[model samples]
Target: MKHLFGNRVIRLLLGNDLLDNIAIWIRNIAVLFLVMDKTGDDPVAVSLITVAEYAPIFLFSMIGGTLADRWEPRRTMMAGGLLSAASVAAIALAVRYGAWETVFLATAVSAIVSQFSQPSSFVIIKRHLKEEQIAAATGLGQSMAAIFLIAGPVIGTAVYARLGIEASLLLVAALFLASTLLVFWLPRVPRETDAERSGGLWSDMREGVRFVLRDARLKTLLLLFALLGIGTGLIQPLDIFIVTDRLALDKEQVQWFYLVSGVGLLGGGVLAAVTAGKTRPNGHWLVAGGLGFLAVSIVVEAWSVWVPVTLVSRFLVGIAMAFMQTALSAMMIRMIDEAYVGRINGTLAPIMTGTLLAGSALAGPLLKATSLLAVFALAAGIVAVAAFCALRLKDRPSAVEAADRA
Candidate 1:
């Protein structure tokens, strides 16, 4: 008997996804370090860079999703890849020329362009797959993505150390181009000729927003995720900063923290995959995972000792993150109509995107006013609220049907 695990599309996506995630992680870590290095530990500058990277999802994500609806996913991916390639190349050149201002500007622009690619990705994947496959696909995608989290910084730092930051940026640029080629395997999408005629892009976006708000459960899920985002986002940059500054780790050593967290992510993915079929009610998973995540963050913040304690805490948090992500994504799939997966996915993007921005922007001020440890504690408190909200979500009949069918 062929193992269900041996699906070809899953394998293909997983392989390319690992490389793709590696590129993204490299770009992100490099930009964070580069910006910090150049700007001399300015938290606002760091926050701005994070904002630049994610803010586009809130601003242009609808446009990107609408474009995805109109065009072929492959073509959209190609365009996005090319645009990302150009942006990264420009950043590389800016660094080479000692144009720090240009470096920050180019990085921001690059992030904006990269967001254009995301909606198409969600649409394309939905168009091709069945509902049951989505979770596994998400699982594998996340697993490989976690692998990148494990390796990207270490590798990026190595390249940055030996070959300079420009070289790493150029490598990232090359990876984007490669992602373009990989996406070419995706089927062609018929363009939305009626995009203008069909109530304009703004109207389409409004409809998506209205649909989610109108759905009782979906609105709840969206808000829950928003709170989740705010919770995690607050801790993310600060966590890295603390590891680097408080723990006194060099660049390469800092990667170990992520590596430990990545291991937890991978372990959680494996658990999700193994137990996906066995589990019937995913809601409990979500609740438990969220609480687990919050607990880990609190413990880490309070007892943050040497590297070992931090690593252990972060690893447990990573596992919780993995479980939470799996459950949340599954819940998202259950809430939407399969036909409008793209639109539904698009609708959720803003909440996730905006929440991150709110967290990053807000966290900067909070960090300035209080201790970083205090900030982590507050974030944990927010997550506890979210988890409480999630517990109130009564599992619907439809969710059960979706699970049974899967």
Candidate 2:
């Protein structure tokens, strides 16, 4: 922990991540509520906010990632931050003029910029951190995200309730600007060589796809990602129902589940960070174990009608998710070549997003057609398959070392 914090690069990156995530949560929650209030609680209007936030992942992630591979990582991230701040500023102005609809643009633009910035962040981590430090760094980074996942909603809602949408937008913009300034403090690194950047954009993208397909480890990881996405998505939109229907409780009581899960995630992330060194070499085992636990937890959670049992299951699920995510991230950084980091992220992210979206789209209809128990069973089944895949993954030489050997 001391060594992790001592690294200036990691410290700066973590700070930037902290601010960025807080701002994102504030923006997302504030916008959703504002839209809800404006549209008289119209479901379609609320859903469009989600579409604006996520559609950019499908459209710009690949392009943004390819660009990150070509551009200087620090500069690319800084640019993304600046662009996000500027977009929010514009949105604030539009809102002041009674153009509340334009608020969606704030979420859309930031999400688009994030597609580029996020890969650049991974590139920087791969370049700057030692292999041994990667796991701790990844764990720490995820821990910050976990913290925000718990606190962000409350903070966003508080800000919106006290200060109104315009002030909340300003606050979000300021957070982005502050994060950009933090990026400015990051050490500048050399850009990719001309030889490395020789391919056309499409060619580079194709190569990235080919690279993942060729690497057995990466191919397996992609499959794992897809399965996890499907499982998580299937249950994500139904948690409220679990409270109201399954537990025979008030819908408002669902917050307890979130709180319990968040606390578990926070603890799990810290555990992952502290044990990262011991666990790094056997990341696949860690991932598998986490997923295996999650599979069981999901089954228990879905099957239980008792509130205490359900909450405990959800808490364990959060812990399992944190461990799995930390292991997966560290393994990717250690296994992939830095040159392909951005493109690989771009390629793999959409698979999960696509699967998640597909599962989410089908979730309601599936529930109406079948039953909650059936949906949860299917989700658990999918995640169990992913765990099995994880068990088959064998640690090998990093991509750079393999290329050199060839």
Candidate 3:
């Protein structure tokens, strides 16, 4: 593990990743609270921020992927990072002048650039990391994500509550600046597709789609990822409402929840790192079981069991998500050609975000019609089916070979 970070490029990219997530987490917490304070906790109004965050992925992910494939990862990452910092700074200034809508606008603009940043991260991984190292990197990435997830919200909210939103935004902007520097420091590796890669953006996107469709394994994985998206989306809309309205948790209690879930995610990430190589044959099971337990946890929360159970469930869900995401990411890196990594990732962004958007919209309506328990049960049931169907998927010893042969 120590040797992994010994690689200069890996260390820089990883640092950039941590800083990037820190900024995102802070921004997310700030915007959520901002909308909440402004609109009296209106779900629809606050939800717009989320919608804005994801809408850009739907609109620009493919283009970003194409660009990543064509451009140097370091250059693309640096560009995106600087642009993100500038945007956040702009938002901070706007907020100071009493422009609340700038939060959503900034979020949307940042998200649009994020389409480029995300693919570039994967591009760095694929180009730099060896086959044996990929799984470990995935686990490490998940751990950083978990740490940021835990710290970002707590710090962001605490800073906002004490110092105010402007402070939170400034903090996020500082992180972004740090991340941009980290990106700039990363050594540039030329892309594999620079010479032969040509054609319009739409044509390149079509090739990406055709490439995935040509492979049964990629096709199946993509479908499962979509289901993962829907399952994730189902619970998201209920989070704030449940915490604020149902549990009536004060700000402090929310921190405790974050602590428990962060610990869970950290645990899961460590476990995944330890088991990455060993879990290749049964990666889908990890995802399936993760999804299944996630649904169960959601149902349990809806069952009106808040305290230790809800806290425990949140932790377990973190574990599940980390396990699933780490396993799948490792598997994807192992199976797919490095050249297609960006496009494949970009291709799935929309499916995930779209379903999440839909779920957020639908869950509210469902809550109006049914109890939270019912809504949770629906998500659980759907994911349970996905898990069961996953059982039918053959555990190919060589997913890449299987895809190639197909």
Candidate 3, which segments miss by more than 4 Å at Cα?
29-45, 91-100, 158-171, 192-195, 239-258, 292-307, 368-370, 391-406
**Order of quality (TM-score):** 2, 3, 1
Q: Could you tell me which residue pairs clash in candidate 3?
A: none
Model 1 TM-score relative to the real fold: 0.79
Model 2 TM-score is 0.96
Candidate 3 whole-model C-alpha lDDT, 0 to 1: 0.77
Q: How far is candidate 2 from the true structure (C-alpha RMSD, Å)?
A: 1.7
Q: Which regions of candidate 1 deviate over 4 angstroms?
A: 1-5, 26-48, 90-100, 189-192, 195-197, 237-258, 281-311, 357-378, 392-406
lDDT string for model 3 (58-86, tens) is 88998898777777888888888778888
Model 2 residue 208 CA deviation in Å: 0.6
* Model 2: residues with Cα > 4 Å off, grouped in runs: 193-196, 398-401, 404-406
lDDT of 1 by residue, 91-205 (tens): 7887787786655665566666656565666665565665555556666666666776677777777766776678778888888788777777666655556634567767766
State the weakest 10-residue window (summed lDDT) of model 1: 1-10
Better of 1 and 2 by TM-score: 2
Could you say which candidate leads in TM-score? 2
Model 3 sits at a Cα RMSD from the real structure of: 3.8
Q: Which window of ten consecutive residues has the lowest lDDT sum in model 3?
A: 392-401
